[model samples]
Target: MVAASAATCLVVTFVILTWALKDVPWRQIADGSLKPIVVLENANGTPLVRQGPYQGPYISYEQFPDTLINAVLSIEDRRFMDHIGVDPQGIVRALFRNIQAGSVVQGGSTITQQLIKLQYLDSDRTLKRKIQELVIAFWLEGKLGKEEILTRYLNSAYLGAGATGMSAAARIYFDKDVEDLNLPETALLAGLLRAPSQWNPIVNREGARQRTEVVLDAMVDNGKITHLQAGAAKSAFAKVNPTRPTPRSGSWFADWVAPQASEVSGSSPGSTTVRTTLVPRLQEIAEKTIADTLEKSGEAASVSQAALVAMTPEGAVVAMVGGRDYKASQFNRAVTAMRQPGSTFKLFVFYAALKAGLTLSDRVLDAPLDIKGWSPENSGGRYRGWVTLAEAFARSLNAASVALAQEVGLDNVIAAARELGIDAELTNTPSLALGTSEVNLLDLTAAYASVRLGKAPVEPWGIIDFKAADQPEAFRVGQQSPQPVDLSPYQSDLVDLLRLVVEKRTGRGADPGVFAAGKTGTSQNNRDAWFIGFTEPLVVGVWVGNDDDTPMKGVTGGAIPARIWRDFMRQALRNPGPDTMSDDSIAGKDNSPRSCNVSACSRAYRSFRPSDCTYQPYSGERRICER
Candidate 1:
């Protein structure tokens, strides 16, 4: 009977062991691979820096310096390799110490055991937890060899303040690399494993040193270092310097870069360095020019807030500005502010006319006109009786424009604006011709740039890539592929007319000691004045207005704001060669000017146009002007 019972009991024990090992899956746990994050760098490859809560870049054991591994080995477990998975003598000693102390003061766990606890087990602090740890630790040892287990443990272990692993420990504690770590630095990292927050060298310097000394004592106890060596290391560690916070830079560059970051990160427009299309040097010149212009014009307080953005002819923003004082107001008026565009809005109306097949020479009566119930008057409040389509548009006659808007479809005008990326809900009414619909400055700038790029619209983006520091090698997924670049369905002639909008009509406001293109905008009652311009290499937008929207006497978009933009562009383009004023030969159809006759027209149109009988432009507009 005793022999049968013993045989049955042995079989049951073997079955139980198989069941426990079944769920552990030892083969797959060895390779703890992860990818590295990709951070955006500037043209010179300097990381586009941002300061915030630490976002850890996971690092691997291979990248870790030998000094770090040695320090940890020396301090925590010199016998790490010699032990199978646990240290029996240490556990027995801990139990005896706990009994003598009359409490569970210390529960001895090898580094390998602790790694199993941190990575895969629980921290219940009960007898059950101890047993659970034993099972997982046994499995870890069975699956990952001792070296693999140690490496993963060192790499994934949590340090402090959202940072994980030894790589972060190196950067956080010493602000240095693991390879560069000296003996003292190694000691510091090793001490942090016990309690990262408590032994943080930055917050508690003296305590950190003392705790590190305790690690040195452990090294002595383990015979990894002699007593004299421990004493000398402890003495030398006191001389290491503590980490300090990064410093702050003032104005200009901050004003330019911070807005880009705010737009990309979706954070409040405070100090940040977001990756922008703007070149750093180009942005500097733009700001310097604005400051000098303000100083020269003696309007620093008068025009306290201004914004600018430069873009490639292909529509990539190169340099950007939120305001003259980024520290004061974080509002990104360049990209965010919406106000009446005045004449800048006229390009859409003219384009709408062209799409309707209205030629530049087509005659349109510019007489005082009332639309439905609204009478649209010219800028100086006069009628331009009958003028050629070219003369009416070139001179910016309001009556003629409103008349033309009625000829072409209002929906087409809205569609044109939307084609250039303006999505604001514009009422398809006759008033749309009067520039009544408010639009965002950035959207308008981008729309105008569409005319320059001669391609499809593109949404503005600040960052190319964002990766946390120390992100693992395997985690680098980099930029997404098949970038959404659409450039079809847009008529090329539309961009050509847009270039002309800046050249003949808006040149006074857009010229910056170079051949550039842009438009000037003024809201009703002069509440807001805006100048949006671009050189071949730079796109500049400036807004001048009171925060209260109060009318400034005679603050037209062409005067002070234009002066600011011109000054800024002049400085911004000093290095880049002059913009080539290549004509985008308008195709599809010459629908520029509706019919207009200058015979006996009102003083407004007649004064803006010469008393001529016949005139013609490349876009096939007929007008009467002196040679």
Candidate 2:
């Protein structure tokens, strides 16, 4: 009677297996077809960035270390090579354990059953699904060799750190290739298959080490390694420290390039290369500068945040620090933080004067007076009685700047800013010249770049080229040309005026020991401090402030912001070398103006005085003028 009952059970099992195997596509178990991951490469061809839910390249069994294979087999299914597909002993043991715990505490699936579930079955814990998994595992083993099945499983497992496969996991954890992994590293990786995130070293180092010990013990019990060998491997793994992946620099720049990536690569994925205008060296310098400055002086000054954006005159973004630390905050202050620009807006005010038939020689009153009941005063409440617009700009006199803005319509000043590529909304108020309106660092820096570019329109961009897997060549982007403008002469003169600010004026702290020029800005109550400067090769904007809009402790633009700007530029120019000048004053530089011959300067002055010194665009030369 017992034999007859067993025969009846075997018949039922055979019928269930036959029914489950009928619909399965058994050929795919041997033929590998998996999508590869997308890679974001820098200009240097280094694969430094990637986003996932993405798959990495398939690693074949031949490339895997024997220790890794043995570790997985010993922990996952000790009888894998001996059994047909399902290990009956493991199932009975799991059932006994679950019964003792009064819950399902262990998975009894063998490696083949696990592969079948991973490839073809849903994760439903039902008798019917288990039957299907068992049957499909049998058919999969028949079609694919043991090595091929292991390869597919390893290639498809989802590891942490945005990696999808063993090869990528190896690279992410140890920065090593799969073939270079030592026995301990291989064992650690093998142990993570059960629960990737829970056993991640960065998240739970102790848990991962404990899991590795379990795998090492299993390997020893299975005779894959001796007890002594297991102990030695565990000791080696414990002594080694893994390097965690650092947050990428220029994260804001990367965010800007994300959308453009799809546009260039079309719809393809896997191993994409994006060549951006970012100079990694410059990016590192910019990030370190902001971090060091804030670390050194932020707490005492009541400041807690800062940002920087650096670009070329042609509008290629070389370096950008969105904030003090990108991991803590991702909002790009350089492109999105719209705080009041303060005296930095004086750059646009003076540029408006130049555009509206006013020369640097023209005079503006620095003495305070009420303008429609809105009185403006210089920073220190002391002012030079009457000064050249050039001197007024260099000193950043609030009253003089406002008076000049009144002389030229507020609309004209806004127009001048727009022409220079500033797109932020400007308020049409008397205090607009004092930069009561808020603007982002990116636009302001680009506007300054426009001044240095001398009629070349600014269209700042981050990408230079892009390529995806299966593509023949990189798709070109970020190619820029000088846009035509009628302000060449005025632009040259403006450059000289800005030179004075860095040479011997309020912006003196921004001097980079080179022929650099820029402007300083300090908002009300010292809430914001900014310095936007340009050398021949780079235009950099720095802003230091509190994120909560609280006031700082006298942190003017010329103080911390200028020092950061100076430090960054000194490092940037130290290699390519700066165009050193003979004297500290702009008047003694080789490119100092000889005379002003522009009609506006001549008409504004009654007689030619050397004190009427201003840059004149004459015969394609910028000369200091006595008009």
Candidate 3:
């Protein structure tokens, strides 16, 4: 009777277990869907940066090395192949060990059982939870088979240092791939599963070495490898060292592009891929240029911070460096830090004057003068008497710039700057001519890029494409055409004057063999130095100074800033083509009027040169003039 009652109880238990198994979520179990993270790519389709914190790159079973698989199996589950799901012998032995120790010191969980608990069960340590884990483990073994279960286990396991699985572990620890891991590396990874943080080689190398030795011994004892192999692995483990983390090259650019990416890809919680306008080659060059320059000249000049921005004339940002080192500080000085533009401000003032019917031959006095009790003096307190606007600009003569600013209304100067994208607040003071107001390096660089484009005003853009797995094509993704502007007639002349600055004056240091034109800006007391220049295809701006706005050791814009600009531009112009022009182009004329006095002539000057003429402001009449 007792045997018959036991059989009936067993039948009831089996029926209940089968009924509970129906709610196991088989579809989700079959397709392991994990967290998705944002991935940023460069123009060449190389990963520039990763944004999301949770999920990492996924690797399939075929990509994992056999050594890694062997090491993991030997350490985590010796009877994995022989067991159906839960190992009864392991459980029995663990129960006895715990009973002797008077506590649960050891867990008898196989890899499959552990995976079941990780996915379905909570850490209650209750009898009910254990039964559920065992049931799910059996179901997983039956449904997924050994290889699929192992693959899921390998990918789902979390390693240390923000790594999720073998693939991420390989990258984070060794800067390598799973297939490339040596025996010691594989053993080190296997040791991490016991306690990821405690056994992480990067965190505790000595402790990790001891743990790796334990794994190597387990591999030998489990018959996965011979004792001779374990000994060789130990020797290799002693010589192994994990790769330390370093700042990535495009981190600053990535930060700047993240917001635009979010907008293009949608601000959802899941993973999105953002394709940026960054040219990896140019980005590398920009980062290296800043690092090399700072390593050499930073201490000597007392300049601890610098910023750079390079873009196409259409305003597609190709390269950007926010600071000397992103790890030291993430503050993107190029886009956020507003500093006195110094003589770079002169470009806008001259742009206004040229639009107001003033030619490069127009004269302004470099002698000391006062505007509203504000006396402006040229550098070194020396004056060149009366000089043409072209000569004054090339010399960066402050007094001449101030005089020219007064001739053209400050309102016009501000408007002209607005057209080129300088949106910073400017006081209507004579000091405005000397760039007394603050503007960010990015806006200032883009403003100069407008002149390079000649045909349109450039809106600076960083994102080229954005997408996610769900989307067909990227949103807000399209090629931008240049916006038509009224600078065509003056474009060649303006470039000529700028070319003279590079060829004969302050910007001479930035003169590369290619046709280059730019302006050098030195702020008051040497607090800021800037060089904004352009080749036919690229426009770049550079700024160097102290973060505290303190003055450097006489580091003028024409010196270190120009040298840095020249070095970067030389490398950028290495593959110059026929489309590129030489300095001789600066002498070519557009057959436009050399000067215009009437509003009609001024209007004509916007598109082509009207005949040269002088406007008699006092008499309200226009007169023809010769160059």
Provide TM-scores for the models. 0.60, 0.71, 0.71
Clashes of each: 27, 7, 2
lDDT of 3 by residue, 321-371 (tens): 999877779899999999999999998889888989989988988888977
For lDDT, the strongest prediction is 3
Ranking by lDDT: 3, 2, 1
The prediction achieving the highest TM-score against the true structure is 3
Q: What is candidate 1's CA lDDT for residue 547? A: 61
What lDDT score belongs to each candidate, Candidate 1 first?
0.60, 0.76, 0.77
lDDT (Cα, 0-100) at 389 in candidate 3: 87
lDDT of candidate 1? Answer: 0.60
Residue-by-residue lDDT tens digits, candidate 2, 165-212: 787788778777788888888888888888888888767889989989
Model 1 agreement with the true structure over 1-627: per-residue lDDT tens digits: 999999999998677666545554344344543322222334332333323333233444676666567767766666677777788876887799999999985556788888877765556676556655677776667677777777777766766644567655665555665567776677777888878888778888898899788777877776667789878888898788757323122233334444443322222111122233335555556667665665665353355556666655445455566666555666766766777777778778876676677777788888876666788777787776888776776667778888888777788888867766778778777777767788766677777766666554645443332222321111111112123334433344444444455566644756665566666777788877787766665555677776676776677777787877777776665555322112111110222222222222222232322112234545566644322
Quote the lDDT for 204 in model 2: 85
